[model samples]
Target: MAALAATDSADLEKLLLEVCSSPSWAADVAASRPWSDRGALLAANAAAMARLTTADLADAMAGHARIGSPKAGDATSEREQAGIQGVDRALLDELHGANAAYEAKFGHVFLICATGRTAATMLAALRERFPNDPATEAEIVRGELRKINDIRLGRLLDEPS
Candidate 1:
């Protein structure tokens, strides 16, 4: 969307603010050099996410819940639909339980690369990763966030309307 590139800095700022609630992070993303491709744009966004402190990461997580496969009627919900797929109801229930337990243990939401993964697979991953120490989990969470950004940037850079 080169037209988006042509947008003024203030408009760009507003757009990013809509995408991410963190003011400092949004400002940094808006001030970044114009990207020629989706990959570059996503890389920059991921780098910014990686730089956030643990508390900041928690705030970002609060902005996003699990990517729901069948999106509800809301912007943020639709955004989450990108990474969701239908799965067995039982598996979904188990995943929800696991997610709650994981959050209680880690003091942060469970994060995973959800693109193309089924609920069962994601649940298995969550269970497997539950044993990692906080430092290790933080790195994993950053990687998952980068993957999500990559998906979002691809959508953003699609051919203009």
Candidate 2:
């Protein structure tokens, strides 16, 4: 927290963007800096996230890789989607099909905080959310994004020893 609170504006913005792809969100969070603890930083994150417009949320969601197809070299995505790493090929194909259906329905990748969740669990969520109307799904996406952002922020402030 102290390190981030003391980082320069540009550096801070860059770091926050890694946590959330939305420029407005990063700026909003960076502006509320000098946080004294994790709770304060997360509160700031939640507030900024709540203020995001539809377009802003879209921009934020753009940062995440689709669940089954983690980007080749993105450590963040790889780590967060670790549950799918060594799963069977049949399950992977099923995940791919489910991802396509979800995307077609929502017009965006299914977003979930996959850090500690299994691939099967994520697949089930995609199926569950597939039936939701766009507005409700958008809110759910926002909530998932909020969880992801909170985890990323904690990672940013609390480096491993």
Candidate 3:
């Protein structure tokens, strides 16, 4: 993977395609090029995510529905478990409602970094963000995407070291 980063743009693009899905476009952008510095890589990632259109953002969100609190024996669930707490039945229902409402308003699924957050906290964020206009909301989405990317990348790099 490091070798591919030093290759040409085409190879880099291919490597990115392999490493990240539509939902994780920021990671794809980050992985595509070898960065001289981590800051540059993170900046590029933020820019790439910010450039996504609403439809693109929505597509990304749809691709990541299962990224919430991890269930036992589920990697995603486990990842989420560290971030999400107090996700009882009532809170889940509220989250569902907030998700639906946010999607309805923006035509995209709500995007957030669920790590280390309670269901109530997530719900509050969703409700607060619901009032943003498209332009404002896109920035918010990009911020959330960055946070999620950071968490995922940390996990990826921490494997069995």
Candidate 4:
């Protein structure tokens, strides 16, 4: 909250986009600057995301890194998927295969919060979700994107000086 309040508008927009790569969401939040606190910021984010068009959601989803593939995304994503780091080669292979299967079915990267989940857990979830139809999967994707945005937003404010 303090950090956002102190940041310039352009930088805030960039930061918001980094958290959730939806231009509409980032612009709306940037326009509502000087948030009273983190709660208000979060509420704004949730509302903006709720109102997101399919394109916006797709834009946000496109920003995510695949689970167990840290090299595929930014520093934030690398950190977010830290739990998958240092896992055994077999688990990494499984996660890669699962990611490929998920992408084949969904036509996009499998995105989750991945803040504190292991490769095995993520793989299990990916497999568990394979049977879901597109509509169901989209809803799940929306929920996961929201979680990822929330975690990223918290981290933006939590960064050390």
lDDT of 4 by residue, 38-96 (tens): 88888877878788888888898877777887765478778889989789999899899
Model 1: residue 121 alpha-carbon error in angstroms: 0.8
The residue-level lDDT of candidate 1 at 30 comes to 68
- Whole-model lDDT per candidate: 0.69, 0.91, 0.63, 0.83
Against the true structure, whose TM-score is highest? 2
**Comparison by lDDT, 2 against 3, better one:** 2
Per-residue CA lDDT of model 3 for 73-138, tens digit only, reads 656646564545445777777777778788788877677777777777778888888889988988
- Please estimate how well model 1 matches the true structure, expressed as its whole-model Cα lDDT: 0.69
What tens digits encode model 1's per-residue C-alpha lDDT throughout 18-109?
55555666667766758776666776787788778877677666656653333366554454544345556776778778888888888877
lDDT of 2 by residue, 54-73 (tens): 99999999999999999989
Summing lDDT over every window of 10 consecutive residues in candidate 1, give the lowest-scoring window.
Answer: 67-76
* Angstrom error at residue 129, model 3: 1.3
What's the TM-score of every candidate structure?
A: 0.82, 0.97, 0.71, 0.91
RMSD of every prediction: 2.7, 1.2, 4.0, 1.8
What clash count goes with each model? 0, 0, 6, 0
